[model samples]
Target chain A: MTPQRPTMNDVARTAGVSLKTVSRVVNGETTVAPDLVAKVRAAVESLDYHPHLGASMLRRNDRRTRTIGVLLDDVSHPFSAALHRAVEDQARARGIHVLTGSLDQDPVREQALATAFAERQTDGLILAPTGGDLGHLEAHTGMPVVFVDRIPAGVTGDSVVSTNVSGAAGAVRHLVAQGHRRIGYLGGRRLLSTARERHRGYLRALGSHPGPAVHDLHDPTAAERAAIAMLRAPDPPTALFTTQSMVTTGAVRALRRLGRERSVALIGFDDFPLADLLDPPVTVVAQDPSRMGRTAATALFERIDGYDGPPREIRIPTTLIPRGSGEL
Target chain B: MTPQRPTMNDVARTAGVSLKTVSRVVNGETTVAPDLVAKVRAAVESLDYHPHLGASMLRRNDRRTRTIGVLLDDVSHPFSAALHRAVEDQARARGIHVLTGSLDQDPVREQALATAFAERQTDGLILAPTGGDLGHLEAHTGMPVVFVDRIPAGVTGDSVVSTNVSGAAGAVRHLVAQGHRRIGYLGGRRLLSTARERHRGYLRALGSHPGPAVHDLHDPTAAERAAIAMLRAPDPPTALFTTQSMVTTGAVRALRRLGRERSVALIGFDDFPLADLLDPPVTVVAQDPSRMGRTAATALFERIDGYDGPPREIRIPTTLIPRGSGEL
Candidate 1:
């Protein structure tokens, strides 16, 4: 059995003082008499009592619950996890707790979670919005929203995103400069704006060369299968461009399995752990999700403090690190 | 200005129906006629109306919010992220939302968070408690609590953890079997029970060799520095026993920096992404954080549904994968 902890009442009884006096002492009020304070402190020490600051803060009518909600693509995904941590770091510093959820690209789920935050006393919302129309988000207008990673059409809010279009275009140009014309494109679901923009960049760079073998799929397994099939084809591309980090990993695995690690050139969008450790070390266009998260969170807090200014769209620059894979 | 979303009033006006009729239609009342239903549906589609499922359920006092809160050491850490995903998966299946926080090993923060969850209408809490004295949790004893990853010293609750002691011992024994007598132990913060238990295991496994060099560190930088010093020592250990994934990563970095990866053996406690991709694939005693999270959540839901039984201590087994790094 867990030893029962002494409550304020217990401390009061032990110290021959009122419960209010014990609470005052525990909360560090200096109004109490020295002798009474000493007794209360001794009782508190004996009982190992801790005054619950968060609990009492929530009880006040005007005091903030000091909690925010974050809805991302999926908390388990590496990108989402990194972004979540960045937001958390910013929030944690301000004594604000984060309540997070995975949107799963479902508009219905997004609506439910957002409106639910309205009831949960969450101060604000940060969303990497999915689905076509986030118009209904206006229903929860009183609550501020900060869009990260992906910005939805039909809903305007403060957003922080990466330079997906130019980043992808730059990667394609790098590949072209290496004298490789045939390049397959592995992309994420077209519903995501990042995927669409990356695909557009590929098209823009592809002035010729059969428009590059394109496979737009969601998740790594599907991307891996597509890569395998494309590589096995009669006239497979000598190089490939994977849009997302997950897709990049899948493409890497597929190429390695086919014994073409050095033969096929690849430049992936998004960086992942161990990318530098992979055989030939995967080259990628690295987007700063952490910075995006931090910037979006700062903007959200500004809005939460009643910033009625126009919503701003912040695009972070991307970096291309060439190790070995893209060199081929 | 952001476009205001159409509310029930707007929908009613568009459909030329009463607010009650619109409400009835949105609530899916069977009394509505087919023609009226069609009209309401068209209005709903045009306005993009999404029923607030989370809010409505919360309005009912007796209904469970179906939201479980998880307090981890850090949500961004790969172990925590993986565990969080597992919990979210379990909660999502039952139409539950997960509210998570990172405690960062502060007792005050932990208590504040735990008590705040009490007020936030969380149905259950899954805590990887960092606090040594959690007696104050008695203030909110009504809620169900499941300790995951780390068990609190003073609080009694259900917990699901990996076999840290035996796992570390097994790895140490493996290193010994490989004919390595001198070994160095690189651990996480000693305050963490996992780190302490792992160190104890290391000591237990060091039956003969004058107790291997032990360095208890928190961050990767400290771990890397400690590893460098230990490796450069006059009588350096032939192998290393890293307690956590981050520590393992730091040790790997140090070993690689010194060009001693192939020469010095390492058996890390926790397995992380890209461990297999490292120059010399890292061998590790892999704890199933996902399984721990799933089990902990399952227990939490069981408690939420009135499992008044005694607290449970679930210890999931760990796996040791023999990769290239541990073989030396």
Candidate 2:
């Protein structure tokens, strides 16, 4: 027969330390004394002790797997990537690891990935919900959930979101103040609450004089096509408000191609890298993804730590940055 | 005592299906017939059965936990995030989950995260190593590993990297063709092989008259400072070559502040979002991060699938896109 695998008890006995000390050392708590740590290490090496995390999770009362799952629209997008990094920073600080998935705005994918994470016993979940209803997640009642970027729909939970309406309104107002009554609107899919909120803000600010508006521009290429069509149409708006960064990029390309970049005033929602360095620097209503991420993480941890308060909604404010594009 | 927990056998018996069929359904594999899948679902619900992933991992001979760990320099960085998404896409297609962490070029963090991942029984690891020696990972002999962005150091394993040296040399030659004999270099830490290789390329291409070169600009702020100092110094270089994207942003800002953006030629390595939208449209030698990421994931999955071949090194090519910036 194969030799019996060494256990934490054996290491403790060989090191002449308590089982608790062995547990602490094995769990990487970092509170043990240096000499004691060395002793435990030596004992562990000699005994070839390997702690089974699966078994430990089953044994522990708290069932702390030390892992959390995150769902985003696309992990590669600049905005989503920033939020992910922030969540990661907070999770790492608490000695927790993150498992991330890109939902890609598919409710089916969101439900399937959430179920997969639950089966793996993730301690909690942070998500930018894609579905209209999170009824599927109701099955995992024990797992704490936090929503970011968009508020939870058909569910009660902690949510951290940007000031989408006010931020978008502010961008439109900035353009209107520049004497642009005929301001075009470029936006994302209406399925997203954030997109809807931004469009609402534009309408509220434009107030009775809405110019040409296009929706469902998911990517830059689509946005570019829409911008080109609108510009070619008779009585095209002198200014434009692109509701998303990718949409903004498409609009910029369209303007550049028509040699109208200098003439058409534009303001994009969401700050992108090298925005200021652009020929006519991009003006933007910048949302703080990092702040939103940190807030969501904090709320999730609070729930995990047994905070049973009523669900809270936190909104991070946005800033309107004035650069050459909007000013023109 | 609480009601006895149900097992896969119990699920199979209740559903009148074979254990293998139950296993396939529980594991989320999509080969089960519609009728059989419906029966399995009903039985699972009635019995209130939940699969214990930990137990399943221990019981399986192939020992696939269906999870992989990824270590990146900073998950928020555009290049790193893009690469991560590519890996995630491939992994998700195979129904594998990803655990990601940011190493921030800290060797200690790299070692600690690697060990943490190993202890959690991740089937494999993909990393951009921050250390010169990967001796720390030797303990996780069972786990397959793949390296990205930079080649493996002391240890040997599968690695997918960019044409750092050749790409840098090509960028320098492009600047030379523009009649720029004096071109300063802005680079990252020499601790990284990529940084060193890039600096070497700069030196080789410059031949007899290498201008002021600065090393260890870790962020955009640092690069901006270095660029400003270099420009203000006596006999400033006629052009600048920034070896990284963040460094390029800094150099661009510095030149703008000095009111010499139009006068000095520049070419940055690594394409970022909106590089073309800049005033003079920043030129760059772009590395195919998506391709690099896809290649790394493919190599990693190959290892996990029991391709026990010798260590392999794969290099993805880079392309030079000439916008107005490098031509000045």
Clashes of each: 0, 2
What is candidate 2's lDDT per residue for A1-328, written digit by digit as tens? 5254467889999999999999999878889998999999999988757787777887787778899999999988989999999999999999999999998898889988988888788989999998566886845435789999987668888889889999999999999999888999999988787889999999999888899999989899999999999999999999999999999999989999999988999999999887787768889999999998998998999998889899898999999999889988
TM-score of chain A, all candidates: 0.84, 0.90
Model 2, residue A302: what's the lDDT? 91
Model 2: DockQ score: 0.61
| Residue-level lDDT tens digits of model 2 in B1-328 | 6244577899999999998999999888999899999999999998767787887877777667889999999988999999999999999899999999999998889988887888787989999999557876744435789999987678888889888888999999999999998999999988888899899888889888798999989899999999999999999998999989999999999999999999999999899888888877899999998898899999999998889899999989999999989999
Superposed by TM-score, candidate 2 places the C-alpha of residue A239 at a distance from the truth, in angstroms, of 1.5
Clashing pairs in 1: none
TM-scores, in order shown?
Answer: 0.81, 0.91
Q: TM-score of the candidate numbered 1?
A: 0.81
Per-residue error for A96 in candidate 1, Å, reads 3.5
Candidates' DockQ values?
0.27, 0.61
Task: Name model 1 segments beyond 4 Å from true.
Answer: A1-66, A93-95, A140-142, A209-211, A309-311, B1-65, B139-142
Q: How well does chain B match by TM-score in each candidate?
A: 0.86, 0.90
lDDT for residue B158 in candidate 1, whole number 0-100: 89
